[model samples]
Target: MRPNREDWAAALAAADKGRVAALADRIRDRAQVDLLAPPREGLMLMQLRESVAGAAFHLGEIPMARVHLRLTAPEGVAEGGAALMSDDLALVTRLAILDAALVADLPEAPEIEALLAEGMAARAETQARRALSLDRTKVDFQLLSEEDE
Candidate 1:
């Protein structure tokens, strides 16, 4: 039998924490005694960014599906792009959930919807930093950092 929306949501939540922990472990291991040579920290940072991106890629579509299955939002897709936590798909998911929560008949929707905007700004910033760290263009973050006046 097919599971319900609640089941989907539950499954998503259950896996999220594990995925995050695993990603962190992978980054730490790669950074510490794993990847030798210079630029170890940057390598680890890239790995961590990848981990985050991968998680969002997998779990990002979930929140949108939850909205769709519940028929909370008007039947429509959303916009997306190469954003941090807000991958195009992830952004769509967030928008779907936000729209649904805003108009849904459920009482708990408000609280759940609040998370749509939460961390989005932070995610973008984090992703930008990660991308910069991985830049092979020789961008000097130290110089950039010092120039901020």
Candidate 2:
């Protein structure tokens, strides 16, 4: 995916909690942050469809966590938000902080970029491995002809 603001946000959200925390630590030391909305658990409805133009259906409800936060730095103030598919409060908080930091153009932006690259690489590897395994199970068959007497 193209490396843009939204991309960074997604990357941060997809990253491991430990990795997000470690990346956020790089900016937390020098930035002032405020949590406008504390991380909280919630539920969101999931949707699915059988085909591109197929009718949609409600799959089920999934756990979610979200937070809205702001960061103040020498450069300026930046607002951020985080919504997760899981109810990981800490991870959402970290992602929100990182989002604000990236928006604020903190010195740690480069590090966050690196982390994004690493996450993208890992995801690609996982997808490749899964595809390879799936390819092995592909089935092929042909129609047989009956003998004529």
Candidate 3:
């Protein structure tokens, strides 16, 4: 199944860094990229809510990077932006370029989609492993009346 655009940034961020860099470089070589604003790196507050009270509170600060840029290829021009909870500005910038390239339907869009698929698969595998580990530790509690029966 095709991934939704809303999931692109997270999938791209989790993709192989070397492949991402190579693809972004190739796109840059063929397209004109203009940064809408200087790439940014800073901390963002992490928020969480209590399940019972449904009250929100600051979890902590996380390092983040964001990029906004426009890509102009022969096919068309497109804009993309990425904000990720990571300190790597270059990676975030590359992800933004890839996002715009996909939006513009550049020749490299297929490769970008492949990378996204690989990333999503890897993420799913990791989640499955974690779930198995949790399941191993699961405890079943039985009430005294049920146990007596």
Candidate 4:
């Protein structure tokens, strides 16, 4: 299944970087892309919420890159934007292009969807490995009372 708009960014971020770049480059070569806003690179204030107190606090600053652009392809035209926690402006710009292509339902949409699936699968595999590692170190504590009984 294709990822929804809300999940599109995450899927793109998680997918293989080389593959994503290739697809983005292909779309870019055939389309007229106009940057709606100059590609930006800066630090974003990281925020976090405390689970216990339900309070929000600024964690720290994280390097971030953002891109907003419009793509005009033969099939359609669409605008796309991407903000990611990295200082790679080119990568972010490429992501924005892919976002536009997918939204435009350009001929490359299926390829984009395939990239998303590959990324999601890789993310799931990484999570599973982490869980297994955690489980290996898990310690079950026995109460003193129970031990005596």
Q: What is the lDDT of every predicted structure here?
A: 0.33, 0.76, 0.91, 0.89
Which of the predicted structures, 3 or 4, would earn the higher lDDT when compared with the native? 3
The C-alpha local distance difference test score for the whole of candidate 2 amounts to 0.76
Q: Model 1: per-residue lDDT, tens digit, 55-121?
A: 4222222212212322222332222111122223433333333333333433434343333233343
How many times do residue backbones clash in model 1? 2
Which numbered prediction scores highest in TM-score against the true structure? 3
Say which prediction, candidate 1 or candidate 4, comes out ahead on TM-score: 4
Q: Where does the lowest 10-residue lDDT sum fall in candidate 2?
A: 140-149
Candidate 3 structure quality by residue, lDDT tens digits, 1-149: 65988788889877898999999998889889999998999999999998999999999999999999999999889998888888999999999999999988888889999999998988888889999999999876676568889
- RMSD (Cα, Å) for all candidates, in order, is 18.6, 4.1, 2.4, 2.8
Which regions of candidate 3 deviate over 4 angstroms? Answer: 137-149
Ranked by TM-score, top first: 3, 4, 2, 1
Residue 27 lDDT in candidate 2: 65
Which whole-number lDDT from 0 to 100 does residue 60 have in model 4? 96
Candidate 2 or 1, higher lDDT: 2
Clash count for candidate 2 is 0
Name the 10 consecutive residues with the lowest summed lDDT in model 1.
Answer: 35-44
Q: Between candidates 2 and 3, which one is better according to TM-score? A: 3
